[model samples]
Target: MASLPQALPEQRAVGPVTRPAPPPIARVRRRRRPSGEPPPLPRQLRASGKWWLGLSAAVLLACVAVVATDTIRYVDVADTRVLQAIAGIRSPGLTAVADAAGMLAAAAVLHVIWLTDLVLLAVFRRWRHLLVWLGVGLLVINVGAAMATTLQRPRPFEVQVLGDWSGFAMPSLPVTVLAALLVSTLYSLVPPGRMRTIGKWLVCGLLVVTAASRLYLAQDHPTGVLAGIVLGVATPLAAFRLLTPNAAHPVRYTRSRPAHLDVSGERGAAIVRALQDQLGLVATDVAPFGLAGSGGSTPLKITVKAAGPQDDGGSCVFGKLYAATHVRSDRWYKLGRTLLYGRLEDEKPFSTVRRLVQYEDYVLRVFCDGGLPVPQPLGIVEITPEREYLLVTEFIAGAQEAGEAEIDDAVIDQGLAVVRRMWEIGMAHRDIKPANLLVRNGTLYLIDSAFAEVRPSPWRQAVDLANMMLVLALRTDAERVYRRARRHFSDEEIAEAFAATRGLTIPSQLRRMLRQQGRGLQDEFLALLPFRLPPVRIQRWTWRRGGLTVVTLAAATLAGYVSVGLLRSPL
Candidate 1:
């Protein structure tokens, strides 16, 4: 009786009381703007080229004004005094040292240094930096010659010239070329940071030695040496800073793949901010992930903080970073493919980083909507407007590549079912290699949809099926995979799949894996089939391909000729 106390009137209810469920957390979806309409770049990210150029211009104008006005006499007098002082202290040893320093600025020495830089840059595939270096060198030489010709000032008066000299003495060409060469070499080869900082001071020290030696030998006036130093260092430093910024084209000595962008330091901080502001994700960490398997773009694993109570702590997401280098790589890749295998169904390169990211995001959404077992499509985050972008998606946790995971019958069926679903939806993942397919708790997940094509050709779809089967068969025997595949695909379809697949059709990764298997798995699968078809001809000739072939050969020949001429030209 005591345990069954009557309910108070205030707490009584006509029926079972039900509290309203908490409102679902509202997620804000960022509306993607057209690529052409990206927000204006922030002022801080704008290149500092204009400022450096202005400073150089001011120096040039000051020198010209001084020489053009009555101030020329004062500069000449000062130059004479400096040379006289240098001569007054000259000894046999100091004079010999000055002669050696003059030789350091010799054209042959500069040529050797320039050629070495070219070779190193070419070897490292730093084509952009190499081009910048060459262009800046030409500009500095031409500009220095023009300025010296315009001034046409004579060597120091009443000072005996002791070293070899050439050209007008107002702005010494040797000193200018030496300064430009040393500065450009440092920027082109040395990475930006403490090392570059130290390299800069070393370059300055060398420039001082050359300038002072020129003054010591009375080969050029002090004003001429100063002008040469200013012009030589400023033009290239500004141009390189403007054209080949460290943010886009980092200089590294590692032989690793060039497509991977450094995901640490300033870039990492930028990524965290972009994710939080643009994609509404509080990213705590961003690091390179699966870089060994990826070649086209940098892969990153980003860890984000939980948003609300429903979230199960923090979660990891996958990101693919695309930049201008990747864009160029895509162009080169497509061009090579066209030249080698003739227009294999839409081999056109993406026009920009934005378009490349947008295409992948669209394909991901389409696949997800079509009920594919792909990663959930997260929004794209802009890292540097049109120059760089990051495509985000859900990370399939605890997943191993299909080749590494133990493939049971269920895994085999799931792999086949992925292709079946793609066929039903008129989609083809042009890259169906082992690295792109992930297995998690027996579920197969397809990734790297950048190459996936919607409404693809039948040949392309067939190639996809073949690639997937080869991947699955690598884990199990071909017979088991074939038997499991038949439940999802017809025998004729499977035959067509193999028929459409050739060496060129298979991705490089899958091709290499098949070679390693070495058991003739492809031939075994062909034997199990009731009927056979000839291997599809992948090399289709086209006028465009022929024209590209001709142009490419011509360009290569011209480049070789130029390189040889540079190497053989007189010092």
Candidate 2:
């Protein structure tokens, strides 16, 4: 090859020596449109998108402020006793506990967002949708605080609260904040599917514990806590609607069979549009279920039978819808205030919905797994995006008539068996009743375990029994029911167990109240609070069934009491 001749500077300049061929002309590919299809609208052009972005940003900013402000004021006056006790016993341990709890909360929040975004992006592969949810969660905490403060709500502490406390009373800030975090986290992390059903129950249980912890610790009032949950959950959900895909046509179901679709991953608005479009096939003639009871706790059952070719009426699946009403103030909105008093949402006592849904789910699942008779738990479903309605498993065959007739001798026996089984496993069906103990195919099946306290002590165990007796008393003559229950044991034995487990007698006032119904039940239950108070649990221990020590803790004491009472009673 001939040696390359050196090019003169002039020649090189002429040939564009310093420059190169213009960057390759890039081509943008346009998505091909199907014939007759309308042109796709830009995502940002939708009105809902604007609202979604705005609402989500507002919620996120609020949450950050609440967390930061609360974190800065680290004193929790309500838990002084518990804290002092722990610190006195183990200095390092107390410090570690405090540090760990704070770390855990922070980690949990971050992890929730991360996992939420990961799942949403992975499933839908949409960045914008993920952003909307992240924003909604971030805003929920601070919004909860602002609302709580605006309301001038008070914490449940009987003594002086530690920090700058100010808020209206209604929705609880702590409970609501927890609810917001949990709902948003679950909504983001888990896709609505077979697995989601279990996850939802677990999450519900977790939230209940959180709320109860707050109440038990005397951090916030029950009403305030519940209010917090409402605000925390509702705000994000409303924002989610704004972020819906079809801005003009949000997801809505009225007298229509809900269609199962991939509503997970996308912004709330998108999910709404998808639901509306997919479930449009449902007949408008079918009347949907409505909300029932105070606090919007009770769910209405909706049965859909197939009338068309696709309909096989005999094999139709039943759906339940839990409805929600707007409350003025909610608990989760005042999270910062509650936390200042050493209150965490999970510590509060279980709510009606909490019992119906969370405890019911756990009881059913655990009993079912233990080979006990239970209604088939098809799974819990969300009727709306708002996290208000929760559907539990309803029996498909042979609906029984409602009334005192529902509580017959056979039903009572079954209830005893069920309670006995629970007791044997070191569990207490805290709210045992004729309604909760359903009769199916002549077999008595336990239904609601909402307040069931598993692995309870003698006191807790007795109170659980007392609650059952109380319920039984409502349906039948108290003396007669007491006599019949004595057949399994003696009156004295029952009383002893009752005393040992619950620590006191049912007040005459409460007894008279039970006869009145409704408010009576509420008052009676509340009155029994002194006896059934959840003990100040210093420690919690989990043990295997086979462990001897566990067996001793679970059964020995209760068994000894029952055995001694039986021996003392006359035949």
Candidate 3:
């Protein structure tokens, strides 16, 4: 039995207890950039003004204005004087040097360089960069031709035309083509750094020599050479800077995957600052993790500083860095799928990086609320509002991939149960490969839910179940896993699952694994089922599909025509 206790006496305050003022709320200053504004320029482009496009347009307008007005007389006089001065110094040796330079800057030599660049870009799979290069070259050629015809300025008449020439020479076509070729090749091939810096100076020197040679040979006016340089360098430089930014389409000779963004240098520092300011999570170190298994977004392991004193140094969180490149890749991927399978599911692409990250984060929260074994969503941190984002989540430490782990009865059940839960919740983990499944402490975890869908198609859900079962059977016997699955799903459901499962439905990683095994794993699983159902037809054509197909074919044909024209163009 317990006894009641007595009351205690009260004591007076020793002194007025002082309370320290709360620490000033730390305020983080964010860049006041508008959402529609482009991403911060890469380091190589930082020194240039943001209005380069406008500036180039202004220069072009000025050139046109000078040609249209009487001011052209003064410019022509200056041009003639400069050509005469160059002609005065012409000697046999000088003439020989000028001829050699003319040969070097000839249209044929420039076209060869252009062809080599195209081949290299294709071999390296730099498709975006390749497109920009082609577009710039075509634009320069067309614009230079039009401008030359409009101005109708003849070759310099102050001296003898020592070199072979043709057509009006307001903007020297050779000089323009040479400038465009050099600029495009440098930006498309050389990685941005000290090497590119040296390349820039060398390119400038070559351009100067070519322009001087043309002037010495009395082939082009000074103003014509100047206009050519301006148009050639400005147009492509602006286009490449805007379209294939170094941050997204960096030129590198290494074998690193393009999907994996470099997390060192400025991007790394930006990540740390963004996490601290936006998410209130102080990240210490950020490094890529499991790059070999990811192809969509760069996976990173972020070490976070602990908030409390009792914490053990720090803990790590997982992050997926999504950029403009990923957004483009997603669009191309969906377009390919739609063209191939005719809209199997909701194959719409996200409009922006923000939307992409938002959808994934929302899906993660939904799965977490529904009691699925997915990573807990830690809010998104925007590195660049619409251009780039980072989706952070709980890092499943000490977990081995399903393919590498010991898949026992419990592991198999948990894996099957995940699909059951997803089905019950009206959700489907569209990607259910061995790489996305993890086993730790006898519990299976599902990750990489970026492709998970809500209220997914019945076929899609069936495919999910089939994929999970196939993954489980990879380690254990098909009959044993089927027997365990029977407890959660019915025989008819299993049959439908296998029926929905096809070559395309399987994730790429799973398909590769199946091929490597050289065993009929999918067929074995199908045999264990009570009965087989007819394979679902995935291809269903529609007006949209037909239109898209036509457009794709037309675009391909245009691209081929442009390629051939580029190789054979008479600059």
Best-fitting candidate, measured by lDDT?
3
Clashes of 2: 66
lDDT of 1 by residue, 1-571 (tens): 0112223433311221122222222234544546665342221424445665676788788767975784777878988998998899988899999999878788789788878999999988899888788778767777887777777777788888888887787678888888888888888899889999999899988888888888889999987887787788788888777677786678888877878888887788888877876887778899999987899999999888765667665678889999888988889988988898785653778999999999999999988787777887778888887788899888887889988998999778777878878887789999998899888777777889988998888889999889899999998898888877777777778899999988778888887888887878888889878788887788888888999999999998986776665545332
Predicted structure 2: lDDT:
0.43
Number of clashes in every candidate structure?
Answer: 0, 66, 0
Better of 2 and 3 by TM-score: 3
**In model 1, which runs have C-alpha deviations exceeding 4 angstroms?**
1-51, 60-81, 150-157, 308-313, 561-571
lDDT of 3 by residue, 1-571 (tens): 1211221212111121122222122223444445665433233444352455555577579767977675877878888888888788889999999999877568678878888998999998989989999999889999999988888878888589999888889789889889988998889999999999999999999999998888889888887888888888888888788787777778888878899998888788888878876777778899999987899999999888764555566777899999989999999988888888785753788999999999999999888787777777878887866788999988888889888888999888788778877877899888999889988777788899888888988999999999999899887778888877776777778889999898889999888888888768788877776568898899888777888899999999999998999778777
Best candidate (score: TM-score): 3
lDDT of 2 by residue, 367-441 (tens): 666545555554554333343334445443453421243566655555555555566567766444444444444
Clashing pairs in model 1? none
- Clash pairs for candidate 3: none
Better of 1 and 3 by TM-score: 3
Candidates' TM-scores? 0.86, 0.36, 0.90
